[model samples]
Target: MSLGAEETHHGSLKPHDSLFRDAEKVSHSTHRGSQVSWMQTLSLAFQSIGIIYGDIGTSPLYVYSSTFPDGIKNNDDLLGVLSLILYTLVLIPMFKYVFIVLYANDNGDGGTFALYSLISRYAKIRMIPDQSAEDAAVSNYHIEAPNSQLARAQWVKQKLESSNVAKIMLFTLTILGTSMVIGDGSLTPAISVLSAVSGIREKAPSLTQSQVVLISVAVLFVLFSVQRFGTDKVGYTFAPVISVWFMMIAGIGMYNLVIHDIGVLRAFNPMYIVQYFARKGKDGWVSLGGIVLCVTGTEGMFADLGHFNIRAVQISFNGILFPSVALCYIGQAAYLTKFPENVADTFYKSIPAPLFWPTFIIAILAAIIASQAMLSGAFAILSKAQSLGCMPRVRVIHTSHKYEGQVYIPEVNLVMGLASIIVTVAFKTTNDIGNAYGICVVTTFSITTHLMTVVMLLIWKKHVIFIMMFYVVFGSVEVIYLSSILSKFTQGGYLPLAFALVVMSLMVTWHYVQVKRYWYELDHIVHIDEMTALLENNDVRRIPGVGLLYTELVQGIPPIFPRLINKIPLVHSIFMFMSIKHLPISRVVPEERFLFGRVGRKEHRMFRCVARYGYSDTLEDPKEFAAFLVDRLKMFIQEDSEVTAQNEPAERDNSSKEVPEAQARLTQTTVEEEKQLIDREVQRGMVYLMGEANVTAKAKSSVLKKIVVNYVYTFLRKNLTEGHKALAIPKDQLLKVGITYEI
Candidate 1:
């Protein structure tokens, strides 16, 4: 069964409420109620930024340290640390993410597929606007346009066509993301919870380490347990807490930045990044890979595209997001210079001793909150994918109608919970998981970069200089991140990749299996010409042989092409084949089902016809459509009024009673009656259940066919609806199938 879009019907409304509403066109808030000032939007954006952008937002802790270990070994590399921090926060986040991907966000949704759909749709329209516009442009310009509108139009059309390849790539990324994020999903709560619990150990020196893990486990159990209570409510509370957390990091960052002047200001320079790669050689690029740790959560932007408004995300990133990240990282670089001999993580360790434990607990809580973005993101992507026919339907509960993206899956949550705890147990430290984290996200980001490059070249009329420079910078950054994680695979990073492989393989297999089954069914179509020929002037109980329908036909020869001629002719003779050749771009309509016949012209013995639906009619289902055609044909042959006009004139000589009898017979044509008889015959095969109709398999091949049919029936039963199964005797009688009645 196909998973179509939900109708989302509304039933009733409360007092002073309308159930029917348009969220995009109709404003929810009254103009008199509030203006939603920029500062207020910024404040809301800050809160949302904390919730949506926490992963990348928290990167200052580890990324700079990971990058500038060489600087730490020496006392004076604060410049290098500052440089890396500046480029990462002020450049990467500011220029690359905030200015680019966010701007490319599709129709307020940000992700590869959403952007793909948006750019493709709009690009095509803009490419070939109209003749009046083309002429007006020519008059306005002294020179001809550089590119033909039609050429650009074809280029985009081809790109959109190539998008199936892009979809597969995106689906690959989705699975990769779900696996890694799920892995992170499991570890986040455990590490965050245990670290928080561990903070108490400093306050209470006698507490055992086992007690910490146990309490951590208990907190995780509870945290995992309550996800069914939608995150929308929790996020409202969590977002503000997270924002304060960012502010804390910001305060500490500025604290370190104000006093230290080891070229701390120069960290804002982009040349530091250029020099880091240039002077340090390949090791510099390799080490700089850890810089991805800062933007690791960038992919979360794509994953969580469905959750927040694109405008809100933009406001958050350029305004609250980048500035806070810049401050924290600068603080971290400054902290290292003063305490090179012994450094704790700059995020927590930068704070004074008096506030250490409290801040540590706060940091851990922030990480748990960070986990929420990915957890919620995975649920949203999977749910939307299922609705779009790219995934299987899992049981999903939409927890917040106000926020359609906030969904809960008991199965998904439970699995994430298990995977997260296992990760905490496996790695035993935040550093270990940190290395594990960036690999999945950066790979996905890299793939998106590649996808967007294709989109730009084929869809957007972007300048070559811009595109070349864009790829060089972005691709190099992604390659650095990927290489950095290669060191971690031997430790624990490969687990997510290995897990992702399993999921990607499963998705590919299911899609192929469905395609095979559908094509086989489509190939067996019986043409109307063949059916008409099968029924010529015969009064017979059975055809006494299986019907053979040929699919392929050669040109001309009255379309009694070789395949049709060979298979549908003179054997048992009551056979048909419908050849439907569809153009990849055209729609197939019912009125196009017509015959091109040779053999059937003389005696209506065998026939061939075509159903003119094109390849683009991708939404049509084989079995359901076949059933629909049967119903329409039944009405047309048995009771349609048109046959009365021609036949009633000749039969007027008969008496009124005789004329009525002939009319009844003509209304129910032999071809329509024969189809019903064949359907009944197939249904009668079910009698093998009760030991009736026990005729032995005749041909050597029929034995395998019978067994295959039996297996198919069993599998089909599992996939069908209860109502559909009820119409079949197998489930109704509950006697034919091997399964027992469980009353």
Candidate 2:
């Protein structure tokens, strides 16, 4: 086992060399401190109002009309519905999300993946099995494991990590939440834009329903077309228009409260909520579906947490969005009580005649802004999904280098735009669009509540009594809304569910097949000992330069290499097996990005480099990656030398004073020689070898599985961004080794 039989070796340092006793220390720290003036903080809060609160702020346009579609029965009905709206606005968005859920962010990143990251760190319920200790060291994965000394904490962690069922359940729950958000992405644009433009019919009564649809479609086309410029440009433009819209609504509401029925303010009492529910019974229960719209974009409070700090989002919501929306809803109720027949188009009709056209113009702009936020949200969710391995890899373009979350996916943008047009044309009314919107919104809310409860029990380790109390309060309210939305399934409610099912099916199939394919490669991977013998065969020609063989196997040599050797009968002078893994954490520190080690033995001239990344990390360019690998390979060589020296015996006497000097000279000489060798080897350039795997099910597999694997998953795989392109690998130096397998 010489590294190269013809090449002479530098004298090897024996064990007990004082200079090579310890390995290099690699320390990781996740803390970062910065100072910001209040002026800067205030600027961010203003921007956050424009970006984070758009969807929720625009809810006033349709909530009242959606609730009383058939028109208000009497003043008491208006009062009751207004009371429900007032309390819901207070309970969910203003209280729970602003004060509580925003605090549960993963290193300032939020959404389903953030919660999953938090929970996975404390327990062993990570669905992906290839996770490493280095992966857990990512900044966002900074949560410490539960203390084993506590019996109850240990029991919960064991239960969550030990059971296969728990892993699947947690993964499924996250997928459902994400899928519903995607559904909202599609529904929100259609409903928001259509409702906005529909205001035109009040002024121009001659305009047909088809005309309104065409106008909405045109608006959406413009919105989606400009998405490539990214939200950083559009977000600032939207905030001022939305701020003015909120002020207009608030001012109009106050005017109507004085001029029409100031007594409608009595709806602020909780007793009306109870009396209304008791009087109307099932009718009032059913209207909960519409009332839920008041908190339509509440999830954005949690979903968009990555874009801003908790304090900024809360300030935007509490200081601006909450009061304006509440006043607008109450003003609509006041106007409706004075003229009960206007309930069908309460938002538009309730406006004072003098300011109707101006308000209508602002409403359209606000709706467009709301749709923009949802579209951006959908892209973010898809990007995170791809990183988590739940979805196929898509082309993700970062619109702003300064903000990691400001991304745009061209494919998703096109799909959402098309879905919006189809829904707007088919539904022809906000009444139907609202039906679909309520279902998606309530379903997502329920899913978040469930995930939060699990967080409280497992990660937060709250007392069972407090956990149950949370469930009884928020969970019970969400369930009621869910029931109400379920009743409208035949109307437009089926739309979001259908969208969710399609997206969920795609994600589930891709993940299942990917896990299976990975396991198959693992079970059949080639061990280094077998490959070493193949390398020594006289029939095989050893070529110059480095071969960077890329594979998914984190530990062993890929089977593709021996297969490649069998065909070509040639090997490179240096072989480095590389694997890039995306962890479920939000971000990985640059210092801990690469993990280097020997393949088997040093004389083999083979090494392994694992380039680990978190979901939020941007991959380095190809040239940078090559340089990084070479640098880390040098470190690995040094660490290996240190470990070997500590294991072997020393040549000099232990008591000799000159022994330290002698060891230092030997260590420096050996390191210099090794560095020269590495420099020479690398001068010949590097080639990247990657496998193009074709996967299919076995003949004995079930028809459903075969269809899923060979058809659905294959389709997705073919359409996604290719590995080399995504990695920014140079085309000239790239080599593809194709392999086919039946799972």
Candidate 3:
């Protein structure tokens, strides 16, 4: 009774007017040929500049001013900062991310979880055990076969799987990375907007600091207010603005190079980096905290890969972003060499006097677009986390059905908006926000290096020397940046660390409770034979309608079944034990998404269906899923008859026809009776059954266990959206059975 190839059309049969109607026609381009049309390539690259590169592109707004807050002291200091900025940009974002990290993309999706998905396929490190063998056929579940290096890879896999400490360390590192990404959603808007609006001071030197903060806060208010409208609209509106911004800044840079001191170009040599560091000494080391801002939004390159293709993103970066940003930085340095007094206002002062007003207007627009990218990335991370069961369920609105990744979580949007406003008002300057921003940026980069090394060993199967070389090179670079940022802990650098700790706690607690709940059901699992024997007694009355019982267990009968029968006297005539599971992949194909089987013989009228989805798959309402299941059940009966007919022998056709005629009569009678029962039951309606558990620590447990389980986990469970609401179950047809559990 499997819903494999035969039930492929069920998704299209959904109502055309449904909110997620476009999800039926999922735009799966993975299987298409490598060669895309020129128009598609161009459009994708253009949109990539708007969505993928906004944060990095806007880095020029604040990097220079932050590096020399008290103003550029000498030519040595200026050239040194420029050299560090140039090499940092070249090493981290350009060489590391562009050439190497992008290759580690998971089935075209990229992020911490995407890397985790790739690593989990070859190791036993995953916490959730819901995935079944049939899940391997999902379109995105890809892993290369073990080859000549199989022995070495297997050894590493065995060591990692058997060790509890290693498993916990890996999980902690991955969650901390994801939490920092969410923290970026709060900090990017604050710094980018404030830096752009700071240009107002150049024109009106009389404007007080409070006036600047007020204007920046007002712009942030408008930015977050329109977030509910979603990024599809925002992307289209900002693409042209960003395109113009790049061209405008590059033009200003070329003019500045020809007009101001051209000797600033000497900073391109690595010698200046050595000379600058040697000259500035300790001050040069401390300033790496600010210089790292040159590559602030580099993570967006990997995080936003789900929205656009790799080739398109690469083209956008190489062809447009790289040259434009380089020219802008060089042009600012040239202006500084001529008028050292203008270091505090490098961007606007460097601009040709006639074009300052136009560039200022464009800078504000570009900054707003940059904030949108971070906000969208945060939503994507949380949505994926929820699917993996690490985060509690929240309302996920798919703003654009054409792209499954374009989502909006209203609760997240409100909180992020409020946080950004608080940061803008409280910090009141990009210098301090830059400190907090540098901490998050460097920490995320370091985590990426660690995860990427794991991918190299498990998935890529690189040689030992190659892995060692990678770790030595990238690991040292990230460590230095991290040390520099941590040195400023007292000056607004503690904010991102505080945010990450809070988010990590919530994720850890929710995951702990979910894993505990699954173990409890496994320990108390029952068998369907118990229910069959009770029916044979003929002591219990059978009700009419169908019953859909949800459970966490994939095999055997869930403990709740017996608990329900004990509490209630009767059961529905036809029953389905259903379980929904998420696999470690990006998207699951429809034909292989449902696994159906009978709980017993045909006479039992009981069945089991497991609905499977990938981490990035769109979830359907429970009512829709139920309708599809029933249609598949009807198809199963017909398919069974076809199989029986085909197996009949040709030599005994005459005799076989007679037997089949009688058998068919009996089968027809049984099917007709079942259909009549189903029709009559439909008039009475169906009901959904679920259990609501109250979890607390065992009596013998220590105080720490009580606080974690009975306090923290319990509070999250109650505060978060309930399972029924998340599944979109109809209230009139829902029944919640309550129970208590001690862990």
The TM-score leader among the candidates is 2
* Model 1 lDDT, residue 476, Cα: 88
**Model 1 misplaced regions, further than 4 Å:** 1-47, 64-71, 116-153, 159-216, 259-263, 270-286, 387-390, 525-743
Please give the clash total of every predicted structure, in order. 5, 1, 0
Choose 1 or 2, whichever is better by TM-score: 2
TM-scores for all predictions: 0.62, 0.92, 0.91
Q: Summarize candidate 3's per-residue lDDT along 506-610 as a digit string, tens digits.
A: 899888878888888777766456766765656566788888889877655777877787788677888778887777777776655556555655676776667
Superior by lDDT: candidate 1 or candidate 3? 3
Q: List clashing residue pairs in candidate 3.
A: none
Residue range 4-26, candidate 2, lDDT tens digits:
11111221112222212121133
Per-residue lDDT value at 655 in model 1:
46
User: What value does the lDDT take at residue 6 in candidate 3?
Assistant: 20
Taken over the whole model, the C-alpha lDDT of each candidate is: 0.51, 0.78, 0.79
| lDDT, model 3, position 207 | 97
